[model samples]
Target: MTRNKGADSVQSEASAVNAPRMTDKDFERFSEFIKREFGIKMPPSKKTMLEARLQKRLRALCMNNHAEYCKFLFSPKGLESEITHLIDVVTTNTTDFFREPKHFEMLLSSVLPDLHKRTNRPIKVWSAGCSSGEEPYTLAMVLSEFADKNSAFDFSILATDISREILQRAVNAIYSEDKVEIVPMALKKKYLLKSKDRKKRLVRIAPELRKRVDFRQLNFMEPFPFRDKKDVIFCRNVVIYFDRPTQNRLFNEFCLRLVPGGFLFIGHSESVSGMNLPLRQVAPTVYQRI
Candidate 1:
């Protein structure tokens, strides 16, 4: 067999072209930019993951290297769209219905009952960093069930995420069948509608339940625009991306937005310990504004 030296050379060049050659300086620059803008800490250990994720954006723009992509990202021409694309690529959106089930249990067994007894006003709940609509819809289902029995009770849910793509999905209020598997059977039956097209294998949140949630795109680094305080804030699993200082500042902000005695529910793996915030721990990963 004759050796195809030309083909071998071409293949070698192609592999080299595809491989990421991001420099340490370039990685540091990106790490610093993301931390400053989004408060997401990306240390040297995440260099490979960051490169892998950002490669998609580079390919989409037909950029050749990390330096060129970084230059474009900082240029006037790439300010708006490129920045949003970078954020979407870097931000984590892992969420599901009834995630961290104990928090929901606490809300049902303890928090809502106390709020109902204390106030006749409409309840306001904020599902901060509510990715792809799961958390807020879960809140709505639970609150809806509560409201059905307590005829005078009324409530609204505000769902926010930094990713516009995720916010749109939240607004659409559609989900895969598997995504709703964690929802209690009774609540699922009451609140979810199977899509008419069975092949889609999708479910839609009931119209009434969907109407109760308002989805918005927001970055926690910026100032919040809430005029009225929230009775409950579900920011679970969102702050894991941020560092301690960022988490402290964000928890304080959550405290300010919460009504006195308002509930704050974080993820199972998270805590408010040693933060010196105004919240008192009421249950595992559950806190109340003091």
Candidate 2:
């Protein structure tokens, strides 16, 4: 006998509403797996946080309990398809336009000029963990403006993130008005397009600006796939999630991909001090590959 469609719908809705909370045992398993796979530390303090993030996944998978979700998440099928989504849910993707304005100031005054002298080739920049495209788009605008005043100054940007969903949003290049408020009016007017309908307080990056940036998915734990080395890498606020050993390993890997004297800008709150790497501090939280 076939089940009634209406009853099935009700049952599913009820199951979601009353889904079981993640148990401590399950959280422990998840924390260990996440740290081993992604290099993200998940301490006991974050058990509630993990539980909350994983709930949406359970709902999406139509699973009513942690047991059901965990079983699928570990299965071969789920590893192939659902793992990306799980990674997306777990990672925090906070970003803003022109965050840490001093970095841009240093870029324009010091880094750009140094690179321009070397060759007329477009300066290559990589924005690791670029969330929703704000940081890279900001970089594009900054670089474009700099190119206008300087002769033979051009650049390309590569924005990468571990989260597939956020990368897609970054590709869309759409943002609410408030999201771009911190952006200077001059740059916004030049690089962003207003929505055709005035009723919607949304904007999109200008086509030229959007095209200048290439968005890709990258996991710090995985081997980086790049044929050419980058001139500068902006990996701000991302390493804070990893443990000390992981951070050191990732930074060393970045150094391997950077041209000698290539600049690295990290979040002001993070430091690369005490780690043995082929880098020297040039400015606050900024280093040059040696």
Q: Alpha-carbon error at 27 in model 2, in Å?
A: 0.9
- Candidate 2 clashing pairs, residues 3+ apart or interchain: none
Best candidate, lDDT = 2
lDDT of 1 at 2: 75
- Report the C-alpha displacement of residue 209, candidate 2, in angstroms: 0.8
Model 1: per-residue Cα lDDT over 148-203, one tens digit each: 88879999999889989888888888899999988889988888999989999899
* Alpha-carbon lDDT, every model: 0.89, 0.90
RMSD of 2: 5.4
By TM-score, who's the top model here?
1
Tell me the spans in candidate 2 whose CA falls farther than 4 Å from its real position: 1-19
Candidate 2 structure quality by residue, lDDT tens digits, 1-290:
89999999999899657757888888888889889888899999998788778888877888887778888888999878888887987899889999999999899888998988987788999999998999999999989988999988889999999988999999999999999999999988898899999899999999999999999998888888885889999999999999999999988888888999899999987888888889999999899998
